[model samples]
Target: MEAREKRLIFPFSAIVGQEKAKLALLCVAVNPLIGGVLLKGDKGTGKSTLVRALANVLPEIEVVADCSFNCNPMNPLEMCDSCYERYERGESLPIAKRRMRVVDLPLSVTIDRLVGTIDVERFLREGKKALQPGILAEANRGVLYIDEVNLLDDYIADSLLDAAAMGWNTIEREGISFRHPARFILVGSMNPEEGDLRPQILDRFGLCVEVSAPMNPEERIEIVKRVEEFHEDPISFYKKFESEEKKLTEKIVKAKELLPKVEISDDLLKLLAETVINLGIKTNRAEITTIKTAKAIGALNGRRRVSLEDLEKAMELALPHRLRDKPFQKPPQMKPPKPKDDKEHNHDHKHDHKHEHKKEEKSGSARNQGIGSLEQNFRSIEAKIPRIESKNFDGSEFTGYRSSRDVSITVVNFPKGIPVSYVPSKGEIRDVDFYNSAICAVLNDKKPPIKLEMKDIRVRVRKAKAPTLWVLLLDSSGSMAVKRRISIAKGIAEKLVESGYIKKSKMALIVAKGNQAEIFVSPTKNYWEVLEKIESVPTGGRTPLSSALYNLLLLANRERMKDKSVKVRAFLITDGKASVPLFGKRIKDEIIELAKALRKKGIELNIYDTNGKGINPGISYVPILKDIANAKVCKI
Candidate 1:
């Protein structure tokens, strides 16, 4: 590594704010057996910087010299072939010490580039097959950093999942087979808006932390000044924090040695289980990860036994990503009270006496009302709120849902707003990604070639499918429906249009009426088209809800075939009064089957029932639609 490159990197200790993120990374360093840490937040929140700085802060590790997999010198069972061979030969193996590195896994990396593959260059030179270590091999005993991990190719992501879980990389392709220990701290950072990490990948991470830009003005100013200084004179800026970095390095080394001694109490373990249960967590992995993290934190704090404080901190870092966050519900922040002088303490006590007197007076009323009672009263009232079969959507308040203001839903898995390469299909060759195609060509070739062949050439492909397509299916059938429903549908359509605008999603409208579905407005970025069509859509026709859904399914399928990465969600605004179907005995039955099939095909459905209140809350057909579609149902 060049001095300039080393200097340019912002030191871990020097990073302002994001203390939670830094702590999570440090916990992993102390106990890499805690799986790994995931940093989730928006761009430019110092996630990548904190991850890279881990390489500089960790103590150097010993490895068998010239071992491709960096086999640990002390652990023979985990040694690579070369290391084991030398050990079996009773030969003295050279030991090498090196600083742990942050090996980057680029978005363009393929299976061959990630796991080991046949050495194409060496094969060409000697005409003999040899294993060329990939990024996983290089990352052994270090840190494998993946920035925008959610954007990684599905194939590469699968490899990571297996290797991460098994602590070994096993590859077999193109007449080459090899296995090597690949135990490393896996650090991944991503912006949730781009795409969600697949569940399997999400499960592999031991700790997940959400970071954000510092909200404090003073903190932001400090960040800006420090960043400016670093960019202006990286060497000078780094020099200022070199002492702090060394101190952190020494701390990490000590923590690792102390980790084995750290113990967790049964009470803390029981508390962790209760917390997970209260949070409605289904997986045991969360419990295990929390315990491991708490122990690591205890070790870091130089404690032999894990405390409640350490457990609380561990839960904070481990549970957010694993659990479904209830809106407006926040965990109790357990911050230690600041020390106060005698005068200040006396003032607080005086205030507490007055508060206690007021509380005592209110206690009678509270007792009468059974304020402290833990009964099923709230549950009964909530149950009486009428289970409208028309709606079964996530109840969490949409992130930016404001009735008096513009509305917005944070749509995930949306098409790339920019040049995001989620789909691993081949496209034009970019210089750096050419190696992937070259390796691919060698694998596909029937026989080993003495020289290159033009026909075997393949180019690297990336998904250019940017911007999601929102298909709105509106029901405008029957005279009564037209008079009572059109206006409700129109109002709902307007809200959805505003939401689409905020989410930067393309909108399309399909109106179903008179035994047919017509594309009122084609998919476009303009929200105005949705509003314009809503105002002039023809109503008072026989319901053809099935046909409308079928149409939406066709559109989704076309988009899926063209580019599987594009997110497509259909909003069905209807009273669920389908009197006609393009084909089938019962229109409702056909619609249910179609809805289920469409959902399976990856198009999400949200049913917005425009039916009126009281006697007829929602049509029977709505429940069937909700069940089959697995959709979020809402009353307009």
Candidate 2:
């Protein structure tokens, strides 16, 4: 056996602050069955550093010497097929001991590369199954680290989470099946400012910890000093913490050994269930993960029985992200204003009519003063805003986050698209599918380099992903002030921008407030800018719906002229109130004409109706706008 090269790594014990993150990592190391941990926070918080340092503190494992899947030597059930077969035949498997590895999964990894691909040439030549192991294989019984996990492609992220939960990776492509154990401690670190994972994927993580840079001056200085020392003499700095690392490693080993023996009382189990229920977390994984984490904590503390403290610590790490708030609940109904009595009205008219007029002015002044209070409570109304979705997707490049199919055979001309499959060629083949060709030859019992027929050619089919542009037209008129409509519109806009970010799309904001509509944000890929701009948009003006639509059409046209294939979609958030006219025509006529013009230009439109019960019930022009513009409408 050859010796492995050693790399300099900061000691785990040397890390300061983030005590909760360190404990979460240790718990997972002690018991991988607790699932995995998600470390979410800002960058430069030592997330990646902690994960890499974790390797030195983990105990070594014994595996078959020549196995690619890191198959355990003594456990046949956990071994790869070949190793199990050899063991079943009374053959002694070679055993080797090595430290558990931390495998880094790159952001650009593809499905075939992640789950392993079959060796087509080998299969055709040898007439046997030969599996090419992937990252999952190497990570078995170890750790898989994914940095910037929130930015990972949704499909790839889903595959990883599924493999983590299932504890196995099964490859069944081209009528061949192979399986390998992929049980590993999945550690994913991400910055929340970049984006967020889907809720379902987020809940799959067994525990989560939020990390941030230390605010204390002393801790900050200490961190800076230690980093400088490490940079000055890496080996010397490592030596300083060698004893502490050794002690921690031994503690982890002991915890793993004690994990099985650690038991929790029935009272603790009931309490755990009650806590999850109280948190409004519906997933059973929450309860199961809490129990497992508590047991691991007890074991790590050298205790045989779980205590309340263990459970408390476990819940802190396990249930924060899983805590769900009731969303989109109907607000409390407002009471109607009382009508004045006829007798009191007549008496006031005779004597105190002037006083009544003064009082009425005072009441109107008070109502006008309350607008600032409504604006202050914008955040409170955000939870009640429902997620918006397009009623129809035109298969345009910007229509969805996933890749859209291009039916043109010219896909081979574009090298950027991923080649997914092969089909029989209809004409001269520009790109050949050699793998499928080899399979075709083998199925026909033909030898290698023995084919010379046109029918044997296969064309590669590719799937390409194109970026999308979301043009948001926000209605910031005074009418939106009623029922906190402007706040809800802002919330919906933020959500849309978030989706745009995930889809790798550009977002632009158009505010229809004041005398006329104006483009607040030009089309750009920086969704953070869009979100920030939405927060400060003030409301108190006429709905210049016509002007907003006109500006949108011009923007869409400009984008189209720049790139012929650019997918542009418009989202108009209004209560169908076109109070301000762009041209000399009536408000209704001008907006309808603009809507028709927009439709004729082939730009997609989606309307978000911010209409609700309020004192000023503006005329809803959504039906006319929707009919004329062929737009999809979502009522908030």
The whole-model lDDT of each prediction reads 0.70, 0.74
Worst 10 residues of 1 by lDDT: 334-343
lDDT of candidate 1 over 218-306, digit per residue (tens): 99999999989988988998889989988988988888888888887664565466556544567888888888888888888888888
Candidate 1 residue spans exceeding 4 A from truth: 1-4, 325-449, 453-636
Candidate 1 has a TM-score of 0.63
Q: Estimate each model's TM-score.
A: 0.63, 0.73
Candidate 2, residues 1-636, lDDT tens digits: the string is: 111112278778998888999999999999998888899888999999999889878888899999999999988888877788899999999999988889999988866678887775566566655667889999999999999887676557778878887888888766668888898888999987665566666776799998999999999999999999988987788888888988998999999999999998765675566445434457888888989999999999999998767887898888777654312111111111112322212323333443344345444442223233323343444445433332223423222223244222225522334577778877666656656766676667777544536676676776655445789999999888977678777776766675666565668899998779999999885555676688878899788888898999889888877866667778888877878778878888887788789888877788877785445455778888889989877655
Screening candidate 1 with a backbone cut-off below 3 angstroms (N, C-alpha, C), the clashing residue pairs are: 391-633, 392-633, 393-632, 426-461, 427-461
Give the poorly placed runs of model 2, Cα more than 4 Å off. Answer: 1-6, 120-129, 325-420, 423-434, 437-460, 464-471, 479-509, 515-537, 544-567, 575-602, 609-629, 633-636
Winner by TM-score: 2
Q: Alpha-carbon error at 249 in model 2, in Å? A: 1.6
